[model samples]
Target: MKMRDISESQRQFALLGGIFAAALVVSLIMGWILFPSLAYARKAQPINYNPPLHVEQIGITCDTCHFFYEDGSWAGIPTLETCVDCHSDIIGASPEEEKFVNEYVKKNREVKWALYVKQPECVSFSHSSHVRMAKIACETCHGPQGHSDPKDYLANRITNYSYVVYDPRVPLNAFTIIRDKGETVWGTMRMDECTACHRSRGTSTACFICHK
Candidate 1:
């Protein structure tokens, strides 16, 4: 009778342990799948800038708006002067353009465009090195920007340590193989993503390579 009771207790313990393990696995799977959406906030753009029209109709390229500095850094946003050079006369007569001209250009103030891809201050990214030396296309990291319609807005969230988002637009190429559902892994300019690319390419994965 004593032996049977002991065996029954052991069996119950084993069953409970198995159930807990299964629950843990399920929780991990669900968290991995659903955490990204829960982690960030998505918002609409204040002003719409059509990339397709500029690229297709007007024959403008990415570099026309987002210029590169001489020192391998990127001038991500175009100055008001750059826009006013052509927009002074209202080429299209669109409301957005008119607003831009009247409100910003005439006022001699720069349009405060929302930045989507913001890197941390401790990191250094060289656009000219990639663009000029690597011969990497801008679309490689920025997605099909030349053809993509202006994004409604960007998603972002504040972490205790930093600001970041998991962008799904990064393409899976030879330079970057890290992917989640055919897109780059949590497409925030995280160290893991950069190190993964460097590791894959046989480049230096030094701590200071990206970090300041």
Candidate 2:
């Protein structure tokens, strides 16, 4: 081949490489500016929370609704005084509820609840933010708690799924396949589990999201 032709080929190859590099830079810039939430990360928290087991239930429970509230806010956490307001009059009526109130509540012990949903201390997710500020409701992210009851165990399972959910919006095969749903035995939480919510709707997945 002629020297001029060889030189021309080299120039063409260089031009193509330059174009690719420029395109990559543009894509990164666009993603960082337009979708910062996709790359955000929160810190991790390891806690040992052993919740009360009511009779035969495992992983799912009816006590979620046992939550107490006056106007709209929770009393921080469920308390002994909260249980008797409804159970004192009918302790013997429902042996199960009575047993729980008398055994756990009477001793001034708070139920050891393993909270599935959590946000980093540095990164705060206020209920009011998604509610009043964003004009959304609890059910929007939490699903339908009103229709959920002891009989409806699915919602409770989803609630206690640690940090997993069925995203209806995902395409038929678009699932991220997070954690592979460890089936062999007991397990530990993973960063992917944290990223699931963090990456959702552009929430942060940065170290600061969890590490204060």
- What is the C-alpha lDDT profile of model 2 across 75-142, one tens digit per residue? 33345565456445434455656556665666656655434344433444434334445565544454
Estimate, for each residue in 1-212, the C-alpha lDDT of model 1 and write its tens digit: 45445677888999999999999998987676455545545554555777678899989888887887776678877887787778886667689877777778788887776655667788888778768877878756665555655444334456412221234365322223223422432233566667776788787878887789
Best by TM-score: 1
After TM-score superposition, the amount by which residue 66's alpha carbon in candidate 1 deviates from its true location, in angstroms, is 2.2
Span of 10 residues, lowest total lDDT, candidate 1: 159-168
Error of 1 at 132 (Å): 0.9
RMSD of each: 6.5, 14.1
lDDT of 2 at 176: 26
